[model samples]
Target: MTTLTTTRGDITTEHVDVVVNAANNAMRGGGGVDGAIHRAGGPDILRDCITRFPDGLATGDAGWTTAGRLPARWVVHTVGPNHGAGQRDRGLLESCYRRSLEVADELGARSVAFPLISAGVYAWPRRQAVTVAIDTIATTPTKVEEVRLVAYDAGVHQEIASSLTMATSVRILQGVRALHRRGYHGLRVNPGVAPSGLFWRVVLTDAADPGSSVRYTSADEAKFAGGVVDAMTTPHEVAEQILRALPRLRPANDAPAYAAWFAGLLAAVEPEHALPVSSADYFDDTDGWEIGWNSGLRYPAPPLDADSSQ
Candidate 1:
């Protein structure tokens, strides 16, 4: 079975078998994810493109090149439809992902990382771009074991998580509800607090008094009621934040068990969001966390492990 996940990070650093680049038809390297990949993969990638694909490629088509200095072994280059250039064909956009996976299969790549094709400089609508990516990648069959959708922007991560129909999002929603049922109050995104870069906040208050609220930021800190916690940038991270707060808010010896359950839920879903925010301190201490329905999927969190130390 193929597992889908999302992350908030540089796609060039992905240690998968293959990393898909959202390239222009020229394939020489342009902007957005394409430029980042080309720059990180070093000159060898461009050299391969010059030698192997002297004539460039067409929109929606895919080709491969050496990874160069990147962590991955191969780079699958796919040209996305430029919606800003009057190219609005959904099929073309979908073909970019499909063709990339087909190319990955040809190379016997077990895992592939993808960026949101046509959503950047191509100007595809963010929500529709995410939907197309999820729909096409989920339906397409391949021997690849894992498909990672890497988003560099917090808003883009939230958009992808919201558009995903996988069971992980559903379970994460359920965990939010479970928090409410446990008598934790004021679980919301505080509009009073503005977002700083990729870091956002979620405020959880004591059920008895609304003013006695504890704020959780996208960083790790030690505090009583209000302090920095993990970044809830993706669905998995959101679920993890809730799970971590449960023990602090209420009496629950089974926090570890619940964490395990949520982790399992995350593993079962397609297009899962995986944001690693353990060492990121993008926001200042004065900028308290933001709280809202969408805030959960705007920041990143630590990875979920069987040891339950997430």
Candidate 2:
């Protein structure tokens, strides 16, 4: 699974294996992404392009060159179809991303950042361009591990993000609830971005610290089943398969609140063949997960959709 992350940021500052440039058919530096890439990457990129392609590259195709002053190791330059010039072939637009990934694979690049091709001066509709980028990348077969769609601003970022199906966070919390690996440990449900693109960082450890040291009644003792979240052991799992991932995953906080969550789940698990569940009434408005699974538990209120409110 090639994890896709859509964020609003400058592509030039992206520290990744490769950055895809929406270059013109000439391959020579011009305006928009073409000019920005060349300017940031310095003269070396242009020199490589000229030396590598004296006759220029064809439209809808891609090739690699050095990433001079930029943070990336290589630049995959692809010519996008100029929709403004009556070049409305969506295949050509899709080729930009597919071909770029091909080039990235050939270069052994694991992570890549892309700009919305043809959405600038080329006049490809911005919203459609985002869909194209996501669809093309998601369908293509490659060794690339991660692809980040770096939007030019917050507006574009919102479009890209909104285009994606919100990964269900409650599912992930359920997965974490089934802890088992090797070492004895406790659990922490943290929400953040990871290399594999999970918003929640599941921490399982027995380290002695201000936040982690309270397990034992003695200075050297510890408690509970010890093991890592094995779901992460495999590479490229999708957000849904993410310890089940991406819905508004605002699980209860681990610090101060972890003890209560742990105690409740432990008690619920004591019943044979039953998965643990929180005391629905204790939830109030904290975590947005389903309020109750116990038949006897009262229905507190409506289920909160985490991503919708965000």
Give the TM-scores of the predictions, in the order they appear: 0.55, 0.55
Computed on alpha carbons, the lDDT of every model, listed in order, comes to 0.65, 0.62
Model 1: per-residue lDDT, tens digit, 1-310?
7878788899999999999999888879888888998899899999999998899999999999999999999999999998999999889988999999999999999999999999987899876788678868866878999998999999998777655533233334444545544533223222122344443334544333456544544332222122221112233344456645544455333334444443443333222333212122453323322222233333222223323543
lDDT of 2 by residue, 118-151 (tens): 8888998775687678767866888999889898
lDDT of 2 at 255: 35
Clashes of 2: 11
Q: List runs of model 1 lying over 4 Å from the truth.
A: 165-310
